[model samples]
Target: MPNTHRLSPVPSTLAVALALALISPLASADDASGTTPKDLDAVVVTASPLKGNTESVATPVDVLYGEDLDKAKAGTLGETVAKLPGVQTTYFGTGVGRPIIRGQEGPRVQVLSGGIGSMDASTVSADHAVSIEPFLADQIEVLKGPATLLFGSGAIGGAVNVVDGRLAESIPDQPLSGRAEVRGNTVNDERTGMFRLDGVNGNWVLHVDGLVRDTDDYDIPGVAILHDHEEGEEHEEAPQPNGTLPNSSVRTKAGAIGATYLGDRGYFGLAGSTYRSNYGIPAGAHVHGEEDHDHDHNGENDHEEHEEGPVRIDMVQNRLDLKAGVYNPASFLESINLRAAWNDYEHVELEGDEIGTRFTNEGYDARLEAVQKTWNGWRGAFGLQFGSTDFSAVGAEAFVPSTVTDTLGLFVLQQKDFGPWKLELGGRYDQVKLKPDDRASTDFSATNLSAAAIWRLSDGFDLRFGLDRSERAPTNEELFAGGTHVATQSIEIGDAALDTEKGVRAEIGAHWHTDRVDLKLAVYQTKFKDFIYLTDTGVEEEGYPVRLWTQDDATFTGAEAEAKIQLADTAAGAWDLRVYGDYVRAKLDGSGLRTVAFDVPHGDHTHGYEVDIAQGGYLPRIAPMRVGADLGWSLGGWRASLGAVRYSKQGDLAQNEEPSAGYTLVDAHVAYRWDRPASSWEVFLDGSNLTDEEARPHTSLLRDYAPLPGRGVAFGIRAYF
Candidate 1:
């Protein structure tokens, strides 16, 4: 394997390893097979279509497990994920946030649950929140970089997979298990109620989950953050009962169900989900023109120019999954497997009178995978997939013009162990078809390939290298849409002759772990040809921003680092600490036109850190670099935890640049449980932004419109039955 020692900071790497080696004498002399429960186990994530340990995968993967979720006191999938590296959100306020990966926003990113696309309008606009709740998730996986193959052509940038219990139905011999939870937040008067159930017995197992949330308009720390034009605003009509309101109430309901059958050889399952949302939509990002003060008569007739209620969207979708595996559980062929799923989504926006526009997408995906026993110390997998989608929209501003697309892909991956070293290589080929309704059809084909290798030189030292090439086609929205979206008020125009986007990325990393610390560093670069961008010409249509979606050739490259240390390990109580951060420089290669996404007149960089307490603590968004300490005690049948996060303001941005200011949000969490696990229940008292810190998320879409919600307190109960 290529030497990746260059990825790390020489001194820190050596110091951490030596410290751990020194402390090894105090640790129990356990076998190298990782037989102790106290040792950290490698997490299984869905970065590759198949399951792979995080440490073994060449690509960068960030995971948020159960304890991590509790620390954040997060309500939605987007809220919890915003804390990970290379992940941010375009917030419509504190209540509505959507994940943005490496500056790539909108439809280019896909959100999934149990490997199937999340059937919601999250991608339709920035103001719409994802229908899936984070509370029910066992873990949230963020896959960064060209992860489009197993997902779809849409994920040119990357994807988020929310792992819930719905897929656990495939497991046999497990009894029905379920949990219930309720929470309330002070910031927006937000209250949430949710429940989840799972079961597996003999030949049949089932899973179901649901959630509902209601809240009033959120409160900002100061005067509502308003554009210069709307600050001293004057209106012709009278206002409603809600304070400073324009239809900004929040309400949502979602439910999912799945069933699986296990036979002597393989298993097949079916899953379906329905999400309904009727929530408040905030005003546009920009409020133009000066405030006119004629009081009652000023601009009374300009009704078309002013939006009355928050933009409302309703989305409904259905999905089905089928799988079959053969060859019982052997040393290698855990069994050959095949899986398929079909999803249909409908999205619509509503104003006072007219249903602005409607979009419907029907998609189907299927894949077959096989695992072979070791051949010369090497094990491998070969897989094939076929997927197709049809989309259409109705109204004056139709973005998706009734198009059908199909893709066929095949791939092979092999892993081998050479003493303490391991190697993995994979390659895939894809053929894509695009047929527009009554338009010139386009048939395009491309090839994708990846290779990675890992070397374990010593007990605490590891080196890894990876390279991949990928391609992506434009979505129906990018190829046909032409209209003014109320949220950002950007006049969007699509191109019919746009070509496929292609690129290659290479990365190298060094990882070391010992008793005192665990540290990792990685560097990567990507070159793109025929890249796509939506360019803003500093123009507007009737006060609405205008931009054209076009293609360009460009390049982006950056580096990242993560580290964790055991500051103090003691018998009375252990004090363990962790820290993680990354810095990225993304820009256009030629003709600095700011055409590439997130690329602008100025270069951009994002960084943050978390100092986790041993017993437990809070993990807020932008969780300032903190110094926290906690204690955990267990006596025979009882256990408890208490901790705090001393958050500090990092920095702030100008009005037009980003919405955020320095502030501290203090928070604490306490929970208790019994030894009779199955019948025991725990209640948690959680406080967030405890300092009542009123701040804004720099990545929020509404940064210019309002501050982050004030302190929120939620009491929740978790019961397993």
Candidate 2:
């Protein structure tokens, strides 16, 4: 069993904008009956400068919060949102999982916190965890498709924005309010607790929040490793771990405090927070092999066996933010908003008691936006954003060189309404510069444009279409990485001569909503001018495989749909049902030429010769088709939900890539609430993987070594005051 002792390691973190209030964009929560809107029509998309709701915006978006968010909350952001259509997770372990949006991962998908880049190194590698904690977020917003016109060219795939309530925009209606929760899991013997408090006095609002989590090695439905299809190829003396995965423990703690001063027409806020985590990487899967020979007393060479110690990561981050905004300005501008943040991040990779490598990143991101008044049905917002980062790594695994990056971007978004037709247009320009300590400085420019239109056919029916062209400057890692990558156990080489990547995407969608029924459907395709990717070179360096980052033309196509139906209120309670499905296909437009050459010993050492061949165009790690259903019900002080999702077997073939079998996951949740004059109390229980199926996602680098948790139950109690 994992230690249940509670410890506070630091004081840090965010003010939040809690979002749980509906089913989909289609319906709104009924306060009197305590029912939620399960559809997508009414939730506001706060990330947009225009401040438009889901239904009012031309982009496809979804917001999760309220009781729905409560039930969906998990240890990692990717797992928390994986059930959503067109979304998947790249799992390194229980401690590391990054969201993969619409067949895109790594730098292509941007993860934001409170409208700003997280400033963490999650994008640098798969083993690095995202800095944002889902337990502290009041609401989460997911945007699908190219979001470059508003955010940046890096967000060509899409973006996930977490609203941490670290700063208060206005004085709360109530004098004081807060919530607290404590939950535990069985599969990993996990324990977690969190709390958030908000208080208002005069024109000032104050906020504070914190969380702690600890878990041991997680149990698996079966053996951790699958047997090899081709037998007798390897030594069978080593035994495989069964029932539980080793070196998979985790411990985390985080905290933050913030306050905002309110004026008659403006507000200013300052906040600070910190986060720390120590997580173990699963053993056996990622191996570092070295041969050692000892000279015997008689001068004979004796070979000895070597074993590697368990690996773990210790990470810490501290951040400070400033926000100032004024509404109803005297000029043509209706509002002015300014946001800025500075952070220092560092993480150390430990091999047993010794430090193997350490990474450090210090950076700041700042932005300013001006909103224009509505004139002749025209509304818009102009934005200016600036950012800089200094990153470096020390020790044996410093695959990427030290570099400093700076960026400046200017963007504009405009919307016009005419009768039942709404048209939206946006454009952005950015200049990015990167200077490496050992390489010459390089600069690149990016241009992005998007156009969309919505036709309101009826009171609750609409059609939406969008088209975009986005360009991206290469990142430092993609251009200069060289040496060993510990996470994937490979020698990664980067090409500095790579050019800017360009993508053109087009999508069409339809939405229908009635008094009790809501539906949404959409499809999209993207063509890349120079799609950059990493591929194995069929070469070896220091006992590790070699992978090279290169570029090629490619195509990606995908579709997604979701529906929610509100049944009539019954004697038991009000019920709602939601069903969703999504699929994506990604392939290189054509094959690429590859070469293999290595020296071999034929009695005497024989010189190697180069052999060139064509490689397959298949893309690796694309998510499989998925379908799921969720049922929700609520009465006065009680709420309940049950859900299941099916992942189809992925047979898509990429050169040297293994196929992943699919599995079904079943989960259920139930909670009861009772209110008092000064506080409210609730107790809840959640069951996951009740069927105990051994499930592994193709997107996981450790898929063969780590399956998801087996049958497990989590129960908790929460208090709101």
Specify the highest-lDDT model's number: 2
Q: State which candidate has the highest TM-score.
A: 2
Model 1 Cα lDDT, one tens digit per residue, 1-721: 2232244234334443553464454333322445332345678885464477777676667788865666553656666786565566666754466666655666667787766566555665566667666777878888877666556556667888887767553463438677777777665677888888777667877889898878787655554544434545654533322223344556777788888777777777777776666665555343322112223335545544544444565556666656567765676675687777787777676655557668777888777878777667877788787888777767644534677878787878777777877877766777778788967777666667777778887666688887778777776556655555545556666676788888888888777666555566666777777766654545434455455566666555555455555555455545554444443434445532232222111113321212211111111122222223334443333333444433233232211232235454455666665536455576777666666555665555565556566566667666757
What RMSD does each model have against the real structure? 9.1, 8.7
lDDT by candidate, in order shown: 0.61, 0.82
What is the TM-score (0 to 1) of candidate 2? 0.90
Task: Report the C-alpha lDDT of model 2 over 375-394, residue by residue, as the tens digit.
Answer: 88899999899999999989
For candidate 1, give the lDDT. 0.61
Cα displacement (Å) at residue 642, model 1: 9.2
| Residue 588 local lDDT, model 2 | 78
Q: Tell me the lDDT of model 2 at 144.
A: 88
